[model samples]
Target: MTRFDAATADGRRELFADAIRAHDERDSAFLTIEAAGNGANAGNDAGSGSESTPWVQFADGTLNLDCTDDELDRLKSLLDEFPSFTVDDLTTPEDVDGTNVRVVARTDDERVGEFVDRVFQRVYNRPDGYRAWVTVV
Candidate 1:
């Protein structure tokens, strides 16, 4: 898998353009958009979950979403509105500029895909927004 950073509006445009191209060519895959957080490196301390950082694990969820510190409260509030969704992990990188969150939406079963588009729209529409990349699942 490869990553294309959409840190700017132009970058976002280019990233989507590439995704469209890939889709048009019929090589569709998974895409992830999350907090870039001032380019900070979320390093890990040697511990039980030391193998990978929380953000990485969170991104591996059924529906991946994230936001900056400025939007954390609102994000949490949005999640609260839907009991089917529960925050699995919330990671704040030491000495970093923001937080990364992971949520899982499941009631009787994993009812997630239906909520992704709505959740992602709210996240990326924020003024401080988040980040994104594409992976060939």
Candidate 2:
């Protein structure tokens, strides 16, 4: 299993998306993904929280890829394709215990779960080991 270090917002999103795709494709049950908040930038206040000063927060998740080698490769490939998708308002190098990678997402839409699910299904198909924080939006 490849060790994924999602220290940044973009990296986190990519990692999360990849894990979801891997779960959908291989039907792996051991691997579990969950949204995790380490309080990296939780209450840093970005202006007045208005349109111009949209408060940025860390939306985090973890992917436990305990699957076979094939599954791991598939997950990696999915992550590599994340740049194809458009992700805005994200910060880089989300520090978690002094590690960094880049993981974040804009949560303005109520259908975030649906959107994530759709992205997973559109790219792969298995439906497991992928979760996100709905309140981020």
Which candidate has the highest lDDT of all? 1
Off by over 4 Å in 1: 1-64, 107-111, 126-134
lDDT of 2 by residue, 27-48 (tens): 5543333332223332232222
lDDT (Cα, tens digit) per residue for candidate 1, span 30-127: 43333233223311121123222112212223344445765677677777777877887778878776776767645421234224423434543422
* Model 1: residue 27 alpha-carbon error in angstroms: 17
Clashes in candidate 2: how many?
A: 16
lDDT at 30 for candidate 2? 30
* Reference-based lDDT, each prediction: 0.45, 0.33
Worst 10 residues of 1 by lDDT: 42-51
Query: CA shift at 106, candidate 1, in angstroms?
Result: 1.3
Among residues 3 or more apart in sequence or in different chains, the pairs in candidate 1 whose N, CA or C atoms overlap within 3 Å are: 34-131
Total colliding residue pairs, candidate 1: 1
